[model samples]
Target: MKIIILGAGQVGGTLAENLVGEKNEITVVDCDTSCLRELQDRFDLQVVEGYGSHPDVLEKAGAEDADMLIAVTSSDEINMTACQVAYSLFHTPTKIARIRSPNYLKYKEKLFQSQDVPVDYLIAPEQLVTNYIRRLVECPGALQVMEFADGKASLVAVKAYYGGSLVGHALSTLREHMPHIDTRVAAIFRRGRPIRPQGTTIIEADDEVFFIADTKHIRTVMSELQRLEKTYQKIIIVGGGNVGLGLAQALEKSHPSVKLIERNPQRAEYVASELAKATVFCGDASDQELLSEENVEQTDLFIAVTDDDEANIMSAMLAKRMGAAKVMVLIQRGAYVDLVQGGDIDIAISPQQATISSLLTHVRRGDIVNVYSLRRGAAEAIEAIAHGDSSTSKVVGRMISEIKLPPGTTIGAVVRGEEVLIAHDDTRIEQDDHVILFLVDKKYITDVERLFEPSPFFFF
Candidate 1:
């Protein structure tokens, strides 16, 4: 596939790097000669130095014959204009633009269709990051949550806390506790990569565990682990940036006691005006004296979503040390994942990483219905739709053992009609049922898709 990407910033550069290994002919265009030079040296691809929004520049980059064109410059206006220009001049099959403004996202569809911008997709990093964080809050016990096929199956990250029933037990011994539950410990991300667990693999305290299971049995699995599910009441957010403000507004509507701390008095006043319920405090979140004065220890959940990684980490660490029940930090740096795994922070959300993952999933949706990079792309939790014309349709009503599944992939759940089926060997798939599978390799996307026919509701 021939792909053209505008803006060689963090997200654009990350996308180029991920797609380089996939054998796609990629061309990146940017006004900054330094970024273009870096990209050319780093990846096996072509780079064009020019303003991406200009039609002549896009033409020079071969946008006319490109399979897909993506504009992700820092300015939303530039990105939108670039997408429009590319679509008008080149008629690219797929056009995607990154618009960071929250207000623009609200009317994205109307702007794209009515205005005839010819953009097929809109990516909002802030909204995507906030949605990811909201899922964590919704499922408090889960260390991470990856929804497949619009909520049919989920890969949930769970931690075995102190005194939990499954804390000291081996992975194989859990069958006695959950004899009827249909789920699997697909992979264990101990330090970073997926570890092959044996029957004797004991669940350690504070171990970040990933489980592939049906959406219905998620609560059952958490209950068996003896993790308490509590509704987040009092919430404290440290930052008035787009991430923090967006999250605060969302939580405020849910009636949670929300407080926002911003170092900038002007930004704090703006957030306060936007969120009347949330008390906006003008002070440094890393200041222990200020946090103590604000009674941060009493907050049920502490969220550090500042623009600075150091500030976010320090604030989250302070909140945890001060006895906050839950602490979540937003770190944009991907390399810091290792630092967070050391256990000072409960959860670290990276907006740029999430954006890259989301975009990569979309680009690879030729066969896969849904894709979530678990354990930082070590394993994937994918949802595939079964087609009636596929070879696997003959085993629609047969047991899973009878069907020939690809290697390194396991059926986690099957959604037929409105029913969420916890997958078992005896569970049979229907013609149009959505099948959720976990795969260790992403190259199996086509093989999994061939198992079923494409569904109309598969993609947005």
Candidate 2:
């Protein structure tokens, strides 16, 4: 696949790194010569330094016959225009643009069309990150939560607590603990090492457990692995930028006691006006006095989303020290994410990862509709639809046990229409069933995609 990425920034670079070794031809375009040089030195891909949205840059980056044009440049106008140019001039098959501004998204369905902006997909990282954190807050105790099958089913990651019913028990006993609730333990990680879940596998304390079930049954399933935390009410957010403001807007209705701290007075005023329930204040978030005045001790969740990594870390740490029940820091540096988790910060999330996951879903082949990166791309949770029939597909019309899944991969759940069925040995997949699978090793993703691909004789 020949792909042109219109940015050399973090998200674009990371996306290139991910796709370079995946048997795809990657070309990156950017104005920063240093960034292009850095990417070229690290990966086997072509890089062109110039204005990303420019027609000349697009052509130089191979837009004429490119399979996909991913415009993730920082500027929303540039990204959108690049998509327009790709479609209007080069006729790129798939044009994905990272549009951060919500103003344009308000008219997305009407504006982004073959006769308009021509973006096949819109990757809004801020909105994606906001949704990610919202899910974590709603599903307490989950390290991560990703919705699939149009929110009918979800994949949740939670750490095993000592007192939970299934903490020390074998995986087979999950049914006994919650007889009516159907769920599947997808994969487990112990001390950063992947563990393929089995009937006899015992869930140890501190083990990271990934499971999939109906969205409504998620909390019930989580309760068996760890005691459910109380619903969060009071929340504190630092940063008045896109992600922070977006998160405040999304959570303010449910969590009425939301407060946001912003260093810029103008942005704070904008946030204050945009949100009805959330209180917005202008102050230095890392200031101990400012946090104290905002009642940090009573805060249920403290989130630092400032653009500066060190500042976010400092503010979140200060809030955690001041008695915030949980602290989640939005760190931009990939290296800092692994460093901050399990310490002062309760959770660490990267907007790049969310953007990458969204892009990868569209980039992937076959019937894959959703793809989530877990444990920093070592693992993946995929939601793919089964197509064709017994003789036309590898997975359709086959039992869960009969499918030749890659090693360390597990069938987590199957979503059929509105019903969520937890995967089991005897569960047979039918055409159009949304199959949710977890792979501890992402190298097996191609195999999974191939398994779901329809034969040459069949078409969706």
Candidate 3:
């Protein structure tokens, strides 16, 4: 970890192309000499050209043996003055920054401890793409959520349509139709990686599962997979910029029934005077007759946060071929999120891979409290927490096939107390458990934090 990124754009060249092959030591900076000669002909880093908030260019981009200094400069005061001069003259031990001013994330922790601007972390890909479209408009059929720690383990993402009834169900018969539900069906991105379902992993109608629960049983696995869609009362949003004006001012201050559309008629009258009860629609969202003359097939949810990724994947596949039903696409090109999740895009949100997975989980804070980079980053679900002089006390109650993990890491769930195990090998991991591992090498994330060593809150 000797990072040092500073804006080469597109979230610092997608966080130096996903920290290249992770043994760290990156270095990027850039006053665009052809984006530092196209990131030095594509990665083997150390690019540095100039002006990453000057000071002799953060001391020639080394920033005093930088262990992490990010600052994604699309100028929020030059990424908070290049992470406050690399944390006040190169004391850079994880400085982060990115802040796109929604009034600097509304007083972000008293401006990071009263402007001691050594921004330990601040990122705001328009508030992480409007908190990832307000967790898919507050779970209106949950096609992806992921929250961990603060909410305590969760990973939602559903989508099995046709006659729903848990389509051809399996994975242990949908756990005997929720016998006191303690969810798990961990991975199943079908035509992608993360599978391990077996018991005839059926459930395929529109198939895009990923459950792993216990954020209070995630509404009992979205009410036993009928794909719960109660709330979201009409919400269209095709792109007015800044993640569609911060998701139409966060669904018009959480009142929903919003609309937006904006194909720049002065940014649709500045998002209709900053979302005056949404419904802006100034024109051309790749006009399928103006998205069926603005009914987008009776929208229930069709967020396609514009800044053109082929007009947010062709207006979210024309609001999922005009039926809407739920279609989210914000693709800030993380390699086109697998070509708009191989079409039919029902949840693509990338905002530069969610601000480089919140700046590599805040430069890998102590024993990783969170870290997502799923599918395309091949794997890394993380969340960790176990400490208690962690070595995970030699497999706390051992079973995960008798604990010798580390192959491409797995232990998908295990929150303990509020129960959410999903992990097999007779599920155990006790002491303050928060587990959630998925890993596929980030250098074995400190050997999966020494098999979950003693961690009782010590976030860097």
Candidate 4:
């Protein structure tokens, strides 16, 4: 696909890095010449220098023949105006803008129309990040939680612990441990390397295990890999930015007590006024005296989402060392993500990785319904619909083992009509079934997509 991206910031840069590998024609537009130069040196794409919303800039960036325009500029007005310009002037088929303000998104029905703002898709990074964190808080010990089949099924990732009963056992023992609840071990990782799972494969401590099960049985299934922690009650968030404020507001109703700390006094007052339940403080998150005064030791979950990565990391470390049960920190750089994961921080949240999955789902070629980028984009779990009958399809009517799956791909679950079926070697795929697949390496995405394509017999 020929694409034009507005903004050379974190989200735009990560999108380019992800899409460029998939063989897309990408052109990035931004006013920062140095950022554009850096991106150009890294990837095979074009970069135009100017205000992203400017007509001349869009035209110069090849909006005339572009199939899609993505406006992820920091300014909401600029992003919205870019989409409108692309729609009115160039008639770009797909216009996706990153809209942050709830006020604008609240009127999405009226604002994003062909004759209005003209945004085909509104990608809210702050909302996505908040929801991602909420899911983690909702599930006590999960490193990552992804819902499939409209929340009927879920994919959870957790680190195996020495205390888990099944920590040093074979995968087959899961059934013996809990025979009633059906589940599947989708994939496993050790030291960032993929390990194909089998009945005889033993799960060791420190292994990152990914599993699939019915949503209701998720907690039971997760218990096999790690000791489940107590449900979160008291929470503390460092940073009064959009993500921090949004997360605090979302958790205000469910959680009994929520505390937010902001370095900026005015922003702290604003956050306190906006939130009815959450208490906001104006102080440095890394300040040991401030954290102790706020009773960080008694907090159940401490999250640092400030703009500065160093501050977020330092604050989270202090919180954990001071006796916080669990801590999560947001890191934007991919290099820093690996350095922090499985370390002092309980979970490392990547804003880029979270935002790119939604954008990539739209960019995928097949009829993909959902896409979850995992392991910092090293792997992906996708839900795609199977079309055509046995005569015209490679998957329909074929047993799971008979399908020519890619080297690192595994069909984890299948949803047919209203039933959810865990994938087995003998399980046969039927037409229209929503197949959920896990690819340890994302390079095989095209191969997986081809397996569901309709053959020439379908046209006859």
Candidate 5:
């Protein structure tokens, strides 16, 4: 695939790095010479130094024959305009834009259609991060929660605790513990190394276990690997930015004890007026006095989502130090995310990963509906629809045991219409079944895509 990415920022750089290794021709455009040079040094891709929305710049970046044009520049306007230019001038087949502002997103349904901005797909990092954090808030003790099959089934990651019922047991014992409830252990990482799960494999304490089950049964399965945590209340959010406000709005109805702290008094007041239940404070989130007044020691969850990575990390560290039970920070830089994770911060939220997943779903072949980048892009949890008959499709009529899944890949579950069935050896995939799979290694993603796609010889 030949692609033009309209930014050399975190999202663009990450996307370039991911696709460059996958046999795709990637060209990045940006105004910053230093940023473009950095990406050029790291990846084997072309770089155009100019305003991405400019027509000449798109032509210089090979947008004419590009398979996709991804506009993820810092400015929403630039991204939106770049997509319009790509569609109007180059006639690019696919155009994806990263739109952060909630105001524009409010009118997105009517705005981004072909008749208007012509953006084929819109990637809302703020909204995606909001949903990501909301899932973590809803399912306590989970390192990550990725929903699939329209929220009917979810893939959850949790650390195996020492005293958990299934911590020292073989994978087969999970069925014994919950005979009535079916679930699949997708993959396990022991000390940061992938471990392909098998029925005989014993789960050790401290291992990161990824499992798939019905969304309602998520907590029940979580308890088997680790002790269940107390439900969150008294949530404090730092920054009045889009992500912070969006999260506050989403949590307000369910959690009335939500508090939002914004350093800017005006934005804080606006947020206060918008939210009926959440308490809004116009003060520095890192201020000891302000946090003390709010009783940070008793706060169940403290989130720092300021635009600045340094500010978010520092404030979240202070919150954790001040005795917040759990602290989640929204960090964009990949380096910062690695540094903060497994330290003071409980979860380092990365919008880049979420954005990448959204983009990959569109880039991937066949009928993949949803994709979640797991374990920092090394793994992937995908939801794909099975199509065609026995002769036409590689997966449609095959049983779990009969299918040739890529190495380290595991079929987790299948959502057939309204039913969520945990994938078993005898489980057979039928047409239109939404198959959820976990791949410990995504290098064979092409094979997975081919498995879902109908044979080339088949007629439409």
Candidate 6:
């Protein structure tokens, strides 16, 4: 695929890195010559220097022959305008934009239609990051919680604790412990290496386990691997930026005892005015005195989402040191994420990973409903809709065991209409069923896509 990406910032740069490996012809446009030069040095992709929204720049970036146009510049207006220019001048087939402002999203129908802005897809990185954090808040013990099959089922990553009932037992013991519940252990990681899960595979303490189950049964299955945590309360959020403010607003209604701290007085006041219930404080999040004054030790969860990676890491480390039950920090650097995660910090949130998943949903082939990057892009979980009959589709009308799944891939669950079914060897797939799959090795993504697509030889 030939693609033109506007902006060489974090999202665009990460997108280029991932897509270039997939053999896509990628062209990136940015106003910053240094940023473009950095991207050029890292990836095998073309770089054009100019304002992304300008018509001349799009033409220079080969937008005319591009299969997709992705606008992710820092400015929302520029992102929107670039999509319009891509559609009006180049007639690009798919246009995707990263829009941050909720004000514009409120009138999405008016702003994003083909007759007007022509944005085929709109991604909100802040909103996506906020939603991702909210799920972690809801499921206190999970390292990551991602919904599949339209909320019917979910894939949860949890660390096995030493005292858990099944922590030192084989994977098959889960069935004996919770006979009535249906769940599948999709994958496991020990000391940062993938371990193919089987009935006899014993789960060791501190092993990162990924499992799929009905959304309601998630908590139950999680307890089998690790001791459940007390429901989180008294949440403290650092930074009043887009992600912090959005998360505060969301938690104000669902959770009481929410506090937001911002160093900028103006931003703090603005957030205070918007929130009805949550408390807002104007103080430096890195200030140990301020944190102690606010009773940081008693806090159930402390989340640092400041723009500065160093500040976020420092604040989160301070929180963990001060006895906060759990700490989560938003860090962009992949190396930093790997180093800090599974240490003092409970989770390291990556904005680029969240944004990349939203972009992949549009880029992937077949009728894919959603895509989630797991284990820092080493693995993936996808929800795809099955179509066609026995003769036309490789998946449809075949039992789970009969389907030709790529090695290191597992069909975890299936959603048909309103029902969620855990994937089993005897379970058969039907047309229109949403199949949720986990791939330990993402290199086999093409094989998975081919398995779901209908055979071209068959006629409708």
**The best candidate in terms of TM-score:** 5
Backbone clashes under 3 angstroms, per model: 5, 0, 11, 0, 0, 0
- Look at candidate 6 and tell me the lDDT of residue 151: 82
lDDT tens per residue, model 1, 1-460: 7999999988888888767766689999998999989999999999999889999999999988999988989989988888888767778788888989877888776788625766788888888888888888877777778887677667888876787788889988777888987677766666555565567888877666777676777888876665677878888998998888988888888845888999998888888898868889999988999889878888788999988999899889988899888899988777796578448787877677678767766677434566676555546676666664333353455578777777777776787887777677788777777777777665565566545544444331
Evaluate model 2: give its lDDT.
0.90
lDDT of 4: 0.90
Q: Give the alpha carbon lDDT tens digit for every residue of 305-395 in model 3.
A: 7777787787778778888877777776677776666458866777776667777776664567788776656666777766453342655
lDDT of 5 by residue, 1-460 (tens): 8999999988998888778877789999999999999999988999999999999999999988999999999999999999999999999999999998888999999999999999999999988889999999999999999999899999999989999999889999998999989999999999989998989999999899999999999999898999899889889999998888999999988985999999998898898889978989999988988999999999999999998899989888898999999999998887778778878999998889989999899988899999998878888999999999888988888899999998888999999998999999999999999999999888888889889999858532
Query: Considering summed lDDT, which 10 consecutive residues are worst modelled in model 1?
Result: 451-460
Candidate with best lDDT? 5
Off by over 4 Å in 4: 455-460
For each candidate, the alpha-carbon lDDT, in order, equals 0.78, 0.90, 0.73, 0.90, 0.91, 0.91
Q: Between the candidate structures 4 and 5, which one is better when assessed by lDDT?
A: 5
Q: What is the C-alpha RMSD of each candidate to the true structure, in Å?
A: 3.8, 1.9, 16.8, 2.0, 1.6, 1.7
* Candidate 6 per-residue lDDT over residues 1-460, each given as its tens digit: 8999999988898888778877689999998999999999988999999999999989999988899999999999999999988888889999999999888988987878999888999999889999999999999899999998768899999999999999889988889999999999899999989999999999999999999999999888888888889888899999999899999999889876999999999999999998989999999888999999999999999999988999999998998899888999999887789888878988999989999998999998889989998877889999999998998999989999898899999999999999999899999999999999999988888888888889857532
Q: Which regions of candidate 6 are displaced past 4 Å? A: 456-460
Better model by lDDT: candidate 1 vs candidate 6: 6
Error of 5 at 438 (Å): 0.9
TM-score of 2: 0.96
* TM-score of every candidate: 0.88, 0.96, 0.37, 0.94, 0.97, 0.96
Give the candidates in order of TM-score, highest first: 5, 6, 2, 4, 1, 3
Model 1 clash pairs? Answer: 143-157, 386-452, 386-453, 387-452, 387-453
lDDT of 4 by residue, 1-460 (tens): 8999999998899889877877689999999999999999999999999998889989999999999999998999999999988888998999999998988988989988988789888898888999899999999999999888888888999899998988989999999999998899999998889999999999999999999987888999988789888889999999999899999989999999999999999989989989999999999989999999999999999999998999999999999999998999999887898898777888999988889888888877777878888887879999999988888888888899888899999999998877889999999998889899999989888788778778866521
Error of 2 at 15 (Å): 0.8
